[model samples]
Target: MIQKQNPENERIKRKFFAYLQGPLGRDEKTIQKHADAIAWFEKTTGHKSFKKFHIDQATKFRTQLQTATNARTGKPLTASTMDGQVRMLKTYFVWLSQQHGYKSRISHTDAEYFNLSRAERRIAHTPKRKQVASLQQCKRAFDLMPSATLIQRRDKALFACFMLTGIRDGAAASLPLSCVDLDEALIYQDARLMQTKAAKTITSYFLPVDPAYEVCFIEWVSYLQNELLFGHDDPVFPKPEIAVGENGFQVAGLSRDFYSNASKIREVVKSAFTSAGFAAFAPHSLRSTLTRWADKHYSSREAFKAFSQNLGHESVVTTVGSYCPVDEERQGELIRGE
Candidate 1:
């Protein structure tokens, strides 16, 4: 059910969304997090205005989040999840107090109550190893892919691009033909032209993976340019078109536009991994896979630099904190002998 409509809150949401898109320039992931937090707060308070926010409300939500269980996992929510949701609200309200018509009702200091305890934030922010797929696992999945249909070709191309470039799913979805220079084995992730993290621009040199992996991407690019007669300025992965056929509803062929969302890419990845006999892994997991690969091949600075550029991160430290955790098997091997 919709909360009782509050004009002020509704206006604030709109303003906040625009602010997020404009000044904040946050990634979709960050924007969505803020939206979820604001939605939860609106639901709790019946769409109460920011002017009515109080310390008690903030403290109570913290307690509620602690007791909350994840709907799918059926376990207590992770501290990271709770921390992000609460922090988004805290930051929003702090900004709200500085806005016109709300200075008296809200205070910048009031936002501090939204923070989790220092112990809780530590638990939330601690680095943990991710169980990313290994190079061997990726090769298995690729070998198992059946390239018999156009959809299949696209699926194979999707995985090939990701496995090689390690670009985020959204950036991959939004990539243009011109962005890809198969001749140079590079992707020009120009931030002015692409929706990259922090809107940072960089050229991603496709790392040397399997020879077959290189062929898969090169062939796909050629197919799009030659067989499909697409120019150098089209979407690398256009959305699928739907049509009514003799057999009723079906996806017929390419839609004339790129995907505005990354859902299709994620779906293709899940299907490919499942068909290859592995449990499902999200498209984002491939980043950790690249990180794992980098750690083995390069020393600390080199590894960090490669991982940072791959993820469009400007700082090596941020890349390490955000994405470079080694799996347990690697940990054991390193510890066992040395």
Candidate 2:
């Protein structure tokens, strides 16, 4: 049976979305996640009115969620996903309880019930070790890939670009030709034009790697400028071309426009790694590699602070806490040296 929309719930959601967008200044992605969380709650409750919510309803929903299985995996939902659902719901109810009409019915204190137990919260918050490719591995991946055709060259260059600069994949996909200075070896991540995290305009210098990696980047840029006659306003990394084939539309060559999103770049990363006989690493993992590299190269607090800023971190602590987890091998070396 299809669940019908609840008009009252819809109205409340609209108001809530407005509140999040305007007063909270949330980006669209955050707003959409909140909206999705609310939609799940509404579906579970048979599309009930928000005004009719009670503490028992919250408790029952929490119980239901604990038993819920992921549609794709057929396993119980992960603790972190459960935690996100509860957090969003709790925030929503807390806001609702303060509203004029809801104040009479819903108590703000009741919102606390939409929380995971202490143990579960700990599991959700714990950081897991991520896979990061070393500079040598990145070079191997780039060198191993075929670069005879236009698309192959683009894919190889794309991998090299990520390894060279450690720019976020989103920023890389949307980067304009003007943002890169081949002579200076600088990338001007202009947030106004590129899709940077939190719209941050970052000035990132090329990390010291094998000179061969820099050559890959420089040659790719030169191809776009001298051979292709691409102007500075064109995308630094353009999209793949589409052409009709016997079966259907097929990727033929390179498009002359920027990719609207980072999905293609992610695919390129996955394929490049798979071809080079390594476990796949996401583009963001390269940032961790760069951070760890910086940790080794810079011992002075002031120098580390500059390194943090180059990665667009407002505080050095943010870089250390989030990305500087020492591997067990490195930890052992430090202990042995001491």
Model-by-model lDDT, in order? Answer: 0.82, 0.85
Tens-digit per-residue lDDT, 196-304, candidate 2: 9988999887777567767888898999999988888898789878999998998887678898899989988887887889988788888887888888888899988
TM-scores, in order shown? 0.84, 0.93
Q: After TM-score superposition, what is the CA distance of residue 196 in candidate 2 from its true location, in Å?
A: 1.3
The CA root-mean-square deviation of candidate 2, after full C-alpha superposition on the true structure, stands at: 2.1
Off by over 4 Å in 1: 1-3, 9-22, 27-32, 46-49, 67-76, 241-243, 250-252, 299-307, 327-337
In model 2, which runs have C-alpha deviations exceeding 4 angstroms? 1-3, 244-252, 332-338
Instruction: Identify the leading candidate in terms of TM-score.
Output: 2
For residues 117-147, what per-residue lDDT tens digits would candidate 1 score against the true structure? 9999999998675656778888888888888
How far off is residue 50 in model 2, in Å?
1.7
